[model samples]
Target: MKNYILIICAVMLSQVSSAQTSQTADKKAILSVLKMQRLAWSDNNIEGFMEGYWKNDSLKFYGSNGITYGWENTLERYKQAYPTADHIGTLSFKINDITKITDDAYYVMGEYHLKRNVGNATGIFMIILKKIEGEWKIIADTSS
Candidate 1:
């Protein structure tokens, strides 16, 4: 009876430990993706910035103009609209919060600022990141 109880407790403890480890790993992955995005923007590499987004026809982005669908279309729009240094400017981000909705998804709220010679634009963004095929990618984003 003593040995059986000890085995049961060990199994339960292992399971709990695994759960916590998985959660931590997921959080780290999500944050890493966010960091990559900031770096890509700071480099003024529109293509690099697109790396954070899901490369799918269903990916969605919404801006002041309206909703845009598909990853390639969004990239094209960004490229055409912000083609020069005066427009790309210096990018900065303040991550307000990141909440895990599930093992595979997270909701992120953040502020973005672009300092340009012409003018500065600042806005808040809410993004939904989904882990697809063990990789974290932004599935949807909405910004003012």
Candidate 2:
């Protein structure tokens, strides 16, 4: 009976450790996704920047103008809005915080700055990211 109890205890401890490791990996994946976005934007590659977003019709984005649905549509909107080097400029992101909502999801709060010929616009972004098929992607985002 003692041996059985020890085996059960070991299993329970392993489960707990696995949970912690999963959470750590989820947080790292989310941060990497954000970093990829910053790099892609800095390169003035809207298509590459879109790689961070979930490639699904249900993906959503909200900004100063309003809400946009669909991953492709969001990419199109970005391309149209920033059509030139002067418009795209350089991008920077300051991630304030990242919180895990569940094993597969996280919430991020960050500040984004874009330097353009017209001027600079700085705003805070709230994002919801999900781990889908071993990849982290932004499912929803809102900024102002």
Candidate 3:
């Protein structure tokens, strides 16, 4: 009876430990995705930057102009807005927070700064990312 109880407690502890580890890895993966985007943007590679985003029609982006839905539309929006590398400039982010919404989703709040020949721009943004097909992808973004 005592051995059975001990085994049960051990199993529960193992599960908890496994969960914590998995959560930590997932959060790290999310950060990695964002870092990749920053690098891609700074390099003036819009397509590469968009790789962090989900390539689905459901992807949403809300900006000062309005809400844009669909991944292809977002790409068009970016191309029209940025146009040239001078408009893109160098990108950097100050991540304010990354909070888990569920086992498969997280919301990230951050400030973005751009340096370019055109003009420097700064703004805050919040993005929601979800794990899809074992990859973390931004599904929604709201930027000032």
Ranked by TM-score, top first: 3, 2, 1
Error of 1 at 88 (Å): 1.2
Please, what are the lDDT tens digits per residue for candidate 3 over residues 1-144? 999999999999999999889888988999999999999999999999999999999999999999999999999999999999999999999999988899899999999999999999999999999999999999999999
Query: 31, model 2: CA deviation in Å?
Result: 1.2
Error of 1 at 33 (Å): 1.3
Give the per-residue lDDT of model 2 (tens digit) for 36-135: 8888898988899999999999999998889999999999889888898788888999899988898788999999999988688789999999889989
lDDT of 1 by residue, 71-142 (tens): 999999889878887888888888898887987898999999999887998999999999898799999999
Clashing pairs in 3: none
Give the whole-model CA lDDT for all candidates, comma-separated.
0.90, 0.90, 0.96
Point out the worst 10-residue segment of candidate 1 by lDDT: 34-43
Model 3 global lDDT (CA atoms, 0 to 1)? 0.96
**RMSD for each of the candidates:** 2.2, 2.2, 1.5
Pick by lDDT: which candidate is best? 3
Number of the candidate with higher TM-score, 1 or 2? 2
